[model samples]
Target: MFEKRELAREHLKFENNLFAQRLVPWPLLNAPFEGSWCVIAPGTASTPHAHHEYEIFIAMKGKARLETGGKSIDFNVGDIVHFTPGTDHSIVNDGTEPFEMYSVWWDAPMAENFLKKHVATEN
Candidate 1:
């Protein structure tokens, strides 16, 4: 039923961070139906970035402040946020302890474009 896949952690690229490492994706969870968890160190911040996928995040531990398309939201533990393709977004750990969150993202069109743009030269 599935056409392509990438193991989260195996193929993870550094999303972004100023003070700590975050988002260790499991390659298997890179698909639209899959998901991953990222741990953010306190006082850390992620720079603005955009993806060609639909994404969602749920704060699992401490507070997480997120910005998207010039809008900001302070998410408490258990709060979930959704984002669409082409939207500029960023994340930050704004609580005392380390922050953990679940991320679910997928984009079929982007994957096709990526393959056409990069994999054509993989051989």
Candidate 2:
């Protein structure tokens, strides 16, 4: 058996060039498994931020220069990267193509607490 959940594309909110869509938003999942798809237009970059989640990225198309915790790594399609908690990270698309990736994250204690509150409200 399989769990089939279909969300229409129109429900996703993609605003601008450095767009991030919570492809499977935590709010929608109402669980700790959070994931998203980011599309960075050529010559744009993502804002550096840190969080409690262990972040993992899988490059699906184009290329990008990733800066994380004072180091830089250039990644192309099929590359993957993982950033630990509190690692300041950002992605830059220097080439003339859209850089897209799928990212997912989950926190242990923090995620547990957040989900507790989230599920409580939904109940």
Candidate 1 TM-score, true structure as reference: 0.63
| Per-residue lDDT over 1-123 for candidate 1, one digit per residue giving the tens place of the 0 to 100 score | 244433444444455663322332333223224456676778876778987778898887788789887877897798988888888888877767877777777678646655665555556
> Over 4 Å off in model 1, which ranges?
1-15, 18-31, 109-123
> Each model's TM-score?
0.63, 0.73
Task: Name the best candidate (by TM-score).
Answer: 2
- By how many angstroms RMSD does model 1 differ from the true structure? 7.0
Write down the TM-score for model 2: 0.73
Error of 1 at 97 (Å): 0.8
Worst 10 residues of 1 by lDDT: 20-29
